[model samples]
Target: MLLMHSQVKAKTPPTGLMSNTEQDQQFQVLVEQHKGILYKVAKTYCQDESERQDLIQEIMIQLWQAFPRYNPQYKISTWVYRIAINVAISFFRKYQRRKSSVDLSDPPMYITEPENVEKEAQLQLLEQFIHELRDIDKALMLLYLEDRSQAEIAEILGLSLSNVSTKVGRIKEQLKRRFSNHKI
Candidate 1:
């Protein structure tokens, strides 16, 4: 969670200034469309319900603030990802500055219906292991889970293509090692 970083360009900048009704409608639509993406990404970043809720709210507020500045040069999904990841990363830093390591022994306080609830136990263990990872590795895994191609991930992360591939490979090996050696 130590990445020292860092959106789709809005198709229109609403030059004339949108009325409250139109702005509210657009905000509602965007929230409805992107909420799941934000949740899944946020869930991967934080292990606790409180942190997840706070992070998502911060991300949404940032997104709303950023709307006016969005350039119309890229996909909206890309822009949203940028904001989501940035928010998560910042939250991680803030948490670390306050308390560096999270204690997993605190109990499973935040259990949503996972894609594979049958494997929730394993998923929780894996989540803890992944949380122990370096910040760049966490970022890479998030992009991978989002199904970003290596090239696309590289672009978003500003990494060389080979660097992305190599780092991902190493992270996989690290995950495998941790899983096998894990006590849980």
Candidate 2:
């Protein structure tokens, strides 16, 4: 159960027309609908369960704060993705810096059930490959794997469409190499 009930509520309603209750209700509904985005972004950036929870909380707080300025012209998912990815990247960097100073042994947050051991191993290897990527490339791969359009990814990550396409191709080749090396 992802903690969607954030303690941080918008201090003021977006339009100042709706009561706080109404605003909270509306925000809750939207967050609930888009909760999967939060989960995936958090999972991508955080390997430890506690760290993932902290990242999710930070993302939720950011989303709450930015809710007022959310443009209606953009899809909600796009906006959510933008904010969540940014927050996750920041969190990951901070965590990395702290980790560099302290040699903490982090454990995997979750493991696949033994339904198919080969598939599980492949998934774990893919996740390990993803974690090996640089921050921006990691974000790009996440969006690409989610099947987000290159244009949408460009918009979210503030990169040109051509840049996104090129980087995605490069990242795919890198992943393929890593997998092949492991296979042999």
Candidate 3:
């Protein structure tokens, strides 16, 4: 399912709040429409399935909360993405801080199956490499995956075009070395 946030950039948001039933229906439609964006955004922020699933649920909750005051004048994709980034960054930081003590954690705190051997190895290496990147590199990767334009990325991330250009160049070099080294 996907959400309605696809490229429909808005000049002014929709003024009215949706009724509970209407909101539910709208949310259902959005979920059916834009689930892929949600999934990708979640994956970028998390290293495991449980966390990814949690992020999706969390995004759903945030969407519900934001729906009432949703300024539809803006592109739904942009607005939803702002929320997704906020949530993912905050959640990842918090989880990292918890230090993941076993006593307070669930038995199934992580899932290890890869669905396939090749996918498993690739994911393992990818995660390791990604974790070793700088914060800006991570943002670049996220924007790239979203297919955002250099201008759009600059706007969303508040970077100068030249600065982004340089960083992306550097990120490419680092990523190449990462792959070549075959070490995290």
Candidate 4:
């Protein structure tokens, strides 16, 4: 079970609105339910372990700040994706500016039993390829791989359905060429 850290403190609710305790409870429930998405986004955007955790924390903070303005008409996942992706993109930009060169070293492997070595290898290769994509494309590909519908992806990314379709097709072609060239 995912638990919100103590760092996520209850904030003052808007006047004539839900109580702070009620708002915090609702936010906690939502965060717990969607934490996996947060983790995936953070990992995809930040390869450094410490930076990834910081990104996740930043994402949660931004989510809480924006929670009061959240519109229920949208799907919860869509809202989460929007906030997470925006935070990730901003964080990526800031990190890029701060560092003269980013280390592209292979990520640490975590295959203890080695039962699915081939599968793990393929996943790592895919992750490497994903990290090479542009920020928006990375978000789109992540959402697609997560089995989000194209419509949902379009909504989250603020792209038209046809544009999302085109981008996915192009992204797949790019990935295919990259894999073939790399002989993965």
Which candidate has the top score in lDDT? 4
lDDT of 2: 0.76
In candidate 3, position 45 carries an lDDT of 70
The 0-to-1 C-alpha lDDT of every candidate, in the order given, reads: 0.69, 0.76, 0.63, 0.77
Q: Residue by residue across 1-184, what tens digits does model 2's lDDT show?
A: 1222332332223445666676677777767777788888887888876667667777777888888787656667778998999899874444443222212233464555676677778888999899889989999999999999999999989999999999999999999999999999
Query: Model 1 reaches what TM-score against the true structure?
Result: 0.73
Report how far residue 31 has shifted in candidate 2, in Å. Answer: 1.4
Superior candidate under lDDT, 1 versus 2: 2
- Residue 61 C-alpha lDDT in model 4: 79
**Looking at candidate 2, what is the lDDT of residue 122?**
87
In model 1, state the lDDT of residue 51.
66
Residue-by-residue lDDT tens digits, candidate 1, 154-181: 8778899999999989888888888778
Put the candidates in lDDT order, highest first. Answer: 4, 2, 1, 3
Q: In each prediction, how many residue pairs overlap at the backbone (N, C-alpha, C within less than 3 A)?
A: 3, 0, 15, 0
Candidate 3 C-alpha lDDT tens digits along 1-184: 1234444533233335445665576666666566666766766777675666666777767776876677765566666666777677664443543322212112342445556666667666776676566655776777765687777677667789988778777776877787778745
Mark the 10 consecutive residues where model 4 has the least summed lDDT. 1-10
Give the residue spans of candidate 3 off by over 4 A. Answer: 1-17, 91-124
TM-score of 4: 0.79
